[model samples]
Target chain A: MTPFDTRGLKRRRFKDKIFTSIVWGLTFSCLLVVFIILFYIFKKGIGSINWALFTQGPKPVGELGGGISNAIVGSLMVVVVAALFAIPMGVSVGIYLADNRGKKWAERVAIAVDVLQGIPSIVIGIVIYIWIVKPVGSFSSLSGSVALAIMMLPPIIKNTEETLVLIPNTLKEASLGLGASYFKTTMKILLPTGIGGIFGGCIIGIARITGEVAPLLFTAFGNPAMVKSIFKPVDTVPKVIFAYASSPYDDWRRIAWGGSLILVVFIILLNAIIKLFERKWKVQF
Target chain B: MKNRWRILENKIFVRWLSISAILTMVLLLMFFLTLLVSSWPAIKANGFSFLWSKNWDPVNSHFGMLPFLIGTLITSFLALLISAPFSIAAALFLGEFYPKGVIPNIFRNVIDLLAAIPSVVYGFWGLYTIAPLISHLQQKMHLQASGLGIFTASIVLSIMLIPYSVSLIRQVISMTPTPLKEAAYALGSTRREVITKVIIPSNISGISAGFLLSLGRALGETMAVTILIGNAPELPHSIFSPSYTMASVIANEFTEAVDEIHTGSLIEIGLLLFVVTTIINLIGRLIIKRAIA
Candidate 1:
């Protein structure tokens, strides 16, 4: 028998061990980073999360305590308005893309959606500023919501299309066979079955735009005082954080941390809800 | 009568859906056209020099995108360089080493959470934590620095990019056929050998496409880069030098720009960013399609 090369075998084994260790080490480091960031955010922001942080408006400069009530209200207003605009349109387009998958126009629209998803938020801000804010002669929460609605469209559409695509064609065939119209088949059969995913997509879309500061930077314009009208400038949590965190005032910076904590908690809740929905509503067929 | 009413309703519904779908395309076109119209004055005045020139004096009415362009390219490429290896390793670990287990699921969730964290939050965190560390390191090295510079921005950007690239790579890696892997194992190959030789070699196209998609993402990231990049419009002379990316410059200047030419120039930069990102994303998407095919 030929002599076996024990040294070569040993070297290969050693190399494999080294590579595996490196992979595990790098992965653990990535996970460690997530923990570190979460830890720091919670630590820094936890103390500042109190009744006043959600109840009152911003205090004047150099003041010790104030809340982001204006920002909180503004965020809700803008995001809810954006959802109102985006959800219907996004779902409609999603349906169109899924129903007419192979058509030339549908393919073009799908590509456009993908490209739209890639456009930077700041650029969206600029376009919206030119299109809405400039023509209206003012920056308003309405304009901000419009920009955000645009940003929200791609994900909502993509998700709805994908979710609908996964549903068996038998459902649609059966619906049509029962003498239901295309509209009825879609509304009665397809949408309800996929509602969990569509709703999850809407929540994800909300989470995405909720923390967006760029498009709002130009369109919302960041009002410090409380705003009641959608046509007026409004403060959002992310915009407030951006303004406050960059400021030199220690008090404002504290408020910024408080705002960050709220934002993070909100996002985490949204994600958890998405996970829950995905698991609960997963259709077997 | 009921059948006729149903047909009418279906036609209306289908028509509305088609209109909505067409509006998505219209919106994209509007973005391009509005940017073109808003930036026309600068485009006309500066001509092609707007692209290659480095001069950006608002008072003198001179605006050029070269420095920011270079800054954007450098920071993005640097971020890709820093992130690619680590993300690849992490992906292999999760998708191959622990492909179906509690450990891999936890790791996957962590990575997804990484992507879910807001970019502004990342910027805020980096400004306080990573920026100070980089500043201290630079001072120790006797280099003039604020800790908020290209390198600092790239580091934070790389962290953000990792979730994206890792998810993409892990997806393609997991999709690597089981039979091929088993064949390598049957041939007395070590796991590392199976990965490096059989799996990676076959999935090279998908892997490259994943990285390309991440690079496209890195190019357009604004908030983290804006907060950490120090917003200097000058060309960076060193890795530690403060600089402006195309997106950051727009975010920093668009609201404050008072001059007509300045506003136009800023819009022009936005136009440039839109075009470049669209092209990169298209190429990445094309590559992904080809790889899948």
Candidate 2:
């Protein structure tokens, strides 16, 4: 090659190198922010995660040491109730969408699901307050579950639909060829085949709502004492974290840290389990 | 008898599926109607002037949403500005430079973890760590800073939104046809040239859709913004000035809004937020659909 061509080549190569380095630098900085946040949480929270954190109720104001057992139970109760309400309906919608892909009504439902997924959790809180809390004349865990259940439906329905869609149509055809009814075909064949993915979706939905604090703020309206009845207001982990972290007391802040750590750990575990499920139970078809 | 039973069960199952499918649309309609009905009092009280008036005195029974509207737009857009570059770079790194391997996988997983961290936890971290840092910086600069303001909240929000754009952009980038890249390379183009000229230009619609979706996320983000934005009611003079957003105001006051007008105004804000986010998301989804098609 001539010298002029060599000069142009060097210039382009240098530009490429500079651009590549910039991309790498920016990417690492983004990753660094993640690590910094993670490290900070673990450092601040490790000292507060003792046995009492899991076993005892919160101490009264001005007290030094207490746990978040009540919050833990409340979170479980709220999230479980949300899952129970969302899973069946979400999965049913999923099956319908998968079965009737191009139908006009099904298409509208699918779009509605997308829109519902995009609605802010805080708005859901307001709607539930007007619909359930105001009508019942009380903030209740049931209202909180309703709010969370709304948030949970999109993910669950999308996952189940996508999973069932991937299963070969031949399976359905063969099941019908065996003279099995549609209900029997769905229950005995389609559901079992897509159970892994459906369960993964449910877990993701649960994880999403578990970390949500907005809807619960006004609906489940926190209580200081542990409450057993779903009609009674309950204090959830996220809600408690919000309450305690904003308070002036150092002890409450510490309890909030403990609660934060518990939530982070639980969500991380849920995500890991999803990955495991995806890998181990991936259908070969 | 067995055949008859199977036929009846089949009919019931199909009917149930259709009803459940329709329930989703019903839920959406209910959300809009409930917000409208609840906010009617405020709409009647304030009328169209509520959209532009700056006054927000609750004691005087006056409520205007302009300041909150401006605050929400500022923070969400500022967050989008801050995160867009980092997300695009990270997406390119993962989708092009390292499409598959241990490193990319780990990076993807870490980003997902970032997304999973509870918003309240992020808010707490911002309150203690980021806010103090900002306060110290402001002190050194001799600026009036409570360390909690639009800028601080935007920083926290940018971090929270990065994972969303990164994941979406990476998917779009990876879906860029292999032949297109090969064609650019065959024409004696370098990797950077191919990216700038071929990949990005071709996939601009999808990339913007990713950003639009992330903007929607930032718009409705409640807990983190509430904790960090200092809850000021007035219009912010600068990024350092504290202000409130539509979502944060609802979160801060809805529970304790004793006055009928106060409660109505808060619900009005929720209605506005719902409409804005819904529009943004619909536009983003439309863009994504077109790009995919």
Candidate 3:
């Protein structure tokens, strides 16, 4: 190579090293922020998580000792109800989208799902308020679950569609060749084959809604007492955190911290499970 | 006889599943229609002036969404400005510098964890830790107002946006054709030069798609902003001034809105948020489509 070319190459190499170092620095800092946020929550919240914090309902104002048992139960009830309503519908839609790829109705449903996914959570709260809360004449846990179910649909649908679509068409062709009907093939073979991914999708959907507070703000409409009925208003972990943290009470804010910790842990665990499933299932064509 | 019955059962089952699938579209239409119908009362009352008017008084029966609209735009844009560069750089590091093995994998996992961190938890952290830290800095700078304002919210938002945008952009960058990068390196071009001259330029659409998607998310974000944005109703004079976003307003007021006008106006705000975020998301989706094409 010519001297000029060699010199130019050397200059570019030095510049690239500096630039690469800068990029590495940026990545390091970004990771640091994520860790800091997680560490901050754990540090601030750990002290607040006592045994009573799990066992009893929140105490009255100015009270020293209480827990988020009501919020815990309320959150679980809402999430379970949401999953029950959303999973079948979402999976069906996913099946439709993947099975009928490039079809007009499928395209329309896909667009609708995307738009629904993009709608602000607070707006869903309002729509559910008008749809269920007004018609039923009260804010209830049922309404909140419906709102969350709407929010949960997109994740489940998207994931299931992607998963099922990855199943080779030859599998379906073979099933048909063996005299299995379309419904029988899909239900018996396809769904089972993609069950891991579908389960991950459901978990993702559930995780997505677990900490959602805005939809429950006007829908479930937080209750101080733990009500056994889904038809009654309920206090969720997120709603409780929002309500307490905003107030001036010291103990309430600590309770909020405890609730935040629970929520963070729950989400992390759900995500980890999804990751494990994806790795373990490592599908090969 | 059993075989014929099975055939009929399969047909009926398929029909039922198809109906369930189509219900998604119907549900989405109903959601949009409900918002429009609910907001009609406020829309009719305010007319076009609602878009311009700054007054949001419920007692006096006046409502305008200007402050919230501006607040949402400013905070989201500010967040984008702070996060985009860092996300791009991180994407470059992961996609180009360390495409595999321990370091990149660790970074990827951390990003996923960040994405899974609940919005309320972020809000809690912002309210307790970041807000106090910002307030302390402001005190040192002798700035007026507490640190719980547009700036604090934007910082928190930027932090949240990084993991999301990085994941998207990194996917884009990593998917760049191998031959393209190889050709650049074959020409004595350095890694940075290959990234700037080849990979990023080729994948601009995907990068922008990621950016727009993140902007959409920041715009609709509620819990974090509601907790950190100070929830002041007035138009913000500065980043340090307390403000409210469209999402925050709906979140903060929808429950307490007693008057029909108040409720209607809040719903109207929700409608506006729905429309803006939908447009942004659609554009992002379109850009991703184009990138794939």
Candidate 4:
């Protein structure tokens, strides 16, 4: 290398320092923001959390030792119901699109899924609130679960179908040649093969729906206390947190942090589960 | 004869799954159609004037969506601008530079965790945490008390989009041919030069596509924008001025929308966002297909 060109590689130490500092600054600030958020939430929210917050109802005015039992039940109910509605339907549809790729309808269905995937969850909530809950004259968990189910469908369908499609056709033909029916072949061969991705899809679908507050806001109609049934109005953590945090009472605000922490934990745990499943079951199609 | 009936059962199973798939397709269509239909009233009533009208005064009968539209675009665009360079660099580093070791896995999982954080928590955290940091910057600069505005929202929104953009760009950069990099290095180019010329040029479309996808994400984002930017529907004179987004407007006011027009206008805002995203995705799909082929 020429000395002139080699000198081009060398610069003032200040320039090097500046470049180094900029890179460090960006990453460090990003890290700091994340750390600070968690710190604040834990600082404000953890003190109010206790076993009583789990066993009893939400705290009333000047009251203490009540629990998020209602919000917990409500959140769990909507999450489970949404999954039940979304998982089977989304997976089966994904299977058809992937396994039956040669069919005319599959391409059309794929486009349709993309459109569905694009629509916002809040819009879904608003539509159901207008058409379903408005006409039904009752705000119920059933409607909220349905909205959440609709919200959950596209992600599960997209990921599960994509995962299944990544499985080579040879496996399907081999299963078919063994006298396995299409349904049985899909069940035993395709689904199991893509089980990790399917699990990931389910985790994503669950995370997407569980945190949905806008849809539930209009349909589920947040009830601060414990819920009795899926057919009735109940409190979920997001809705509760939204309302309680903004209210006049400090206690409600404190509970909002607790609920926020709970919600964050649930989502993180779901994602962690997906990561574990992905590693444990790495069967390739 | 027994085998024929068994075949019939198998046929039924496949067909039934097909029907279920078809049902899902139908439901997806219904969502689009319903959003369009619900949003049509405001669109029809306003005509092209809706896009041009600036004032968003819901108190008066006159309500326009220009400011929200601009706010959404600006905040999201700003986010894409600030996040894109770092995201691309990070993606390349992860895909082509980072050692294939525990560190890569750790970094990858951290990215994944960022993606998993719930929108509401992000929102609240943006409000209480990020907003203050932003406002603190103003204090140090001796700016006004109200510096929590579009720029703040844009930065936070960019933070929200980082994982998606970085992962996508990383995958794209990694997918480039090894020979391309080797050729660049053989030419005696530095690593930076190789990335800028050989690596990025090869994957320019994908990187552009990532930004577009993220732009769409920033546009649709509601919770994060709501918390960081003080929700005043206006075209800010500068980035530090308050503004509202289309999604945040609907979110904040949907419940309290007293009249049908009010609700309809908000839904119309949603419809606009939907159309915008759909077009972006469709164009992206076409580009990706062309790029691959």
Candidate 5:
């Protein structure tokens, strides 16, 4: 080959090199920020997560004896309660949307679900506060869960509907061809196949609701101690973090960071669990 | 008779589930109506100036939202400005340039990981890490107040939105027919020509829609922004000036609002935000769908 083609090749190779460099630059830049944030949180917060932090309620602003045990438990209580109320309703709606006989109505329903999903989280919080809390005139865990449940609903419903619809048409036809009815075909053939996607949805929905602070603020009115009644004022990790981070007390601020870190890890773990479950489902279901 | 019963039972199940599905939509619509009606009281008092005023003082009877509204628009527009080009480039590389190997896998995981990070942690990062970076810039600029203002907040907000924009754009770009690119190459056109002329024109609407949708996200974002922006409320023209957004005001001042009008004003501010963001998203969806159609 002549030097003319060689020069052209060189130019192309040069451009390629520049492009790869940019890509690598972007990848490392993103990782650098993410890792730095995670490390800073761990460095600032993890040391304080001792038995006292978990067992005691709240320490005097400086010395450390009391823990955020109550808030942690309270956070779990609301999240669990919200999940309990939201999942069944969301899943049922998802199933209906996915398995409906009327295609036109299904599309309309899908549009509505999308609109609901787009509504801001704080708006949902305010609406729930008005509908549930104002009537009762108290901030309670139930009210908090209700708000969170509504927040959690749209994702699960949308994901479940989408995942179920993605099932191979042949699978459904096969079940029906083998004398199975529409309901049986869906319950067994469609849903089982979509369980992985549904699980992914569930994980994300839970993660979303767990980090939510604005909604919980109006609904739960942060309590200092672990309250047993679901209808009583409750503390959540996010609420604690928000309240304590801005507080005048240094100890409260440290605990707030610690709480924030715990939430970050929990979210990361849940994501990993969803991926791992998806992988396993790719094998079995 | 038994066969007839079996057919009827199956139909009933189908009917019931469809009804349930329809019900979810109906209920959600009802909830939206409730929100509009419930907030009408606040809306009536504030009038349309609910959006134009900036003074958010609660002690005095003065209620201005121009600052928060401007703040929301400024931060969102800034985020779109910063994130759009990078996301488009990254998406192009992922869709066109990158060999399907470790790099793409890493990129995919990074994108997913970015979305997975909690917003609160993003807030903390803005506060501890990013804010310090801004403070350094402020010193360099010889500014008295910290330069951790709207611009710094916008940077953080942009970082937060890149993942959503990138993946969605990548998906749209990948859906383009390959032959168009092949034809461009066959005509002795370059990769840049193929992308800028062929792929982009085909998917311009989706690309723009993606940016606008993420802008909507930026408008609603509170946690990260609240930490970075110096939360001073006023009608400042410079990005370096500290400001408050509609959302941060709702989050920060909702409880501390002293009286009934103060609380109502805050709610009025939120309603304005909700209306703006919802309209942006709705228009985006319609535009993108129209493009595809």
Candidate 6:
């Protein structure tokens, strides 16, 4: 029997050790950056929170000790309104894409959806501003919602399509075989079966729009006071945070940190809820 | 007669539902139409010079997109360059190095949470934390810096993209045929050797797709870039110099612009950004399709 090449094996071992260590180091550093950023945001933001931080509208430039109550409300309004528009359309599109699979129109719609997702949030704001703001002759919450709805569409569509795709074709076919009309089958069987996943998508969409500030730039335009109505200007958490963060005042900066903290906490909560629901109510084939 | 009536009802309902599906395409068409119409004034006035001209003067009525365009390219490419290695390594760690268990699942969850954190938060973090660090580095290196510039923006963008590209690359790496890796192992290959010689080369297309997807995202990224990019319209003299992206310019100026021409010019930049990102995404999809096939 030939002797094994111990030198070659040693070299290979050394090389493997070096490469593995490098990869592990890279992974550690990447995770460390995430932790550090999370830690830093929480550290800065947590200290700035208080009862006043969530109760009152912003104070004037010279004043101190105010909250972004208006922004909080405005964010809820915009996101809820956006969800109303996006959910139905997104789900419908997703259903169409999944049901039609290889059809030419389905392919086209899929491509369009991908392109829509690629469009910048700022560009969507511009388009929606031209569509709604120019016609209305003012920045309004409705315009902001429309822009966010556009932003929300791709995720909902993608997630819904993915979830629906996972459902066995037999379930759909069996429903059709039972003399249920296409719409009825979709409404009763398909959507219900995919509800958990679709709801998860909706949550993701809402979370996505909640922190968006770019698309609201000209559409919602930040309001210092409370939102008067959907037809008027409004403040959102991210917008408020952005405006305040860039300002020269130390108080505003502190408020920005507080707002950041709240926004981050909200997102973290949403993610946790989604994860919990996914674990509890995952749809099985 | 009763059966015919019921069939007609089904047909109508199906057709109606189908319209909603077709509306996705309609929405895309409308988006493009509005962007084109809004951008027409600037397109007509500036002609081809709008693309190449460096001056973006609202006072003089000249709106050149070249600087911001270059800025966007610089930052996106720089982000990809900096983050791609780390993302590949991270993906390799998850897909190859670690066993599928609690520790890897925890790491995956952390990455997902990182991705879910909003861009504005990244922007805020950039403004407060990263920019200062960048400026400190600038001071140490004896270079002019504002901490808010291309370098800082690219750094923030790289961080934002790491989670994205890592998840995508990890998916691709995991999808690689297990038999190929097994074959490599049977040949007395080590884990690192298997990954390098068998896994990555075979999944190169998917890895490239991941990179392109992240690039497309980095191009359109608004809040993070706006907060860190310094938003100067000047052509970037150095990575440390303040610059603007097409998205940031539109975000910063769209609300406050005084003229139709100004708005039109901003919309033109939006059009440019839209076209660029669309092309990038299309290419990414094509590559991904091939990879999957």
Candidate 1 residue pairs that clash: none
**DockQ score for candidate 5:** 0.43
Give the CAPRI rating of model 5.
Answer: acceptable
Task: Report the candidate with higher DockQ, 2 versus 4.
Answer: 2
How far does residue B57 in candidate 2 sit from its true spot (Å)? 0.7
What is the per-residue lDDT of model 3 for residues B1-293, given as tens digits with 9 covering 90 to 100?
98998899988878876898778878877877898998898899989889889888888999988999899999999999999889999988888788899868878898778888888878888887889888998888788748799999999999888888998888888889999999998997878889999999999989999999999999999999999998888899888888999999988888788988889888888888888888998889878766755
As for lDDT, the candidate ahead, 5 or 6, is 6
Task: State which docking tier applies to candidate 4.
Answer: acceptable
Per-residue lDDT tens digits for candidate 6, residues B1-293, read 97888789878767865897778779878878889998898899989989899999998888888999999999999999999889999999898788499998888788777787788889888998889999998999898757999999999899999988998888888888888988999999988889888899999999999899999999999999998999999999899989999889988888779888988999988888888888989888878777766
DockQ of each: 0.81, 0.88, 0.77, 0.45, 0.43, 0.73
User: Which is the winner by DockQ between candidate 2 and candidate 5?
Assistant: 2
**Fraction of native Cα contacts kept in each candidate?**
0.78, 0.89, 0.81, 0.34, 0.35, 0.78
User: Which lDDT tens digits does candidate 6 get at residues A1-285?
Assistant: 458769889999999999999998999888898899889888999888999999998887799889999999999999999999999888988888888888898888889888888787888888888889988899999899999999999989988888898889899899999998887788888899988888888898888889999999989988888886999989999998888777899999898899988998899899888888787766786
Instruction: Evaluate model 6: give its lDDT.
Output: 0.88
Please provide, for model 3 over A1-285, each residue's C-alpha lDDT reduced to its tens digit, 9 standing for 90 to 100: 554666777888889889988998888888888889889888888999999988899898887989999999999999999999999889988988888889888888888888888888888898999999998899999999999999999999988898899999899899999999988899998899898888999999999999899899989999989889999999999989888887898889888888888899999999999989998874458
User: Candidate 2, which segments miss by more than 4 Å at Cα?
Assistant: A1-3
Summarize candidate 4's per-residue lDDT along B132-192 as a digit string, tens digits: 7778887897777565789888877887888888777777777788898999889866666
- Stretches > 4 Å off in candidate 1: none
Per-candidate alpha-carbon RMSD to the true structure = 1.4, 1.2, 1.7, 3.0, 3.2, 1.9
Ranking by TM-score: 2, 1, 3, 6, 4, 5
Ranked by DockQ from best down, the candidates are 2, 1, 3, 6, 4, 5
lDDT of 2: 0.92
Q: Please give the TM-score for the first chain of candidate 5.
A: 0.87
- Model 2's chain A TM-score stands at 0.98
- Give TM-scores for every candidate, taking all chains together and pairing residue i with residue i: 0.98, 0.98, 0.97, 0.91, 0.90, 0.96
Per-candidate Cα lDDT values, in order, are 0.90, 0.92, 0.89, 0.78, 0.77, 0.88
Name the candidate that leads on TM-score: 2
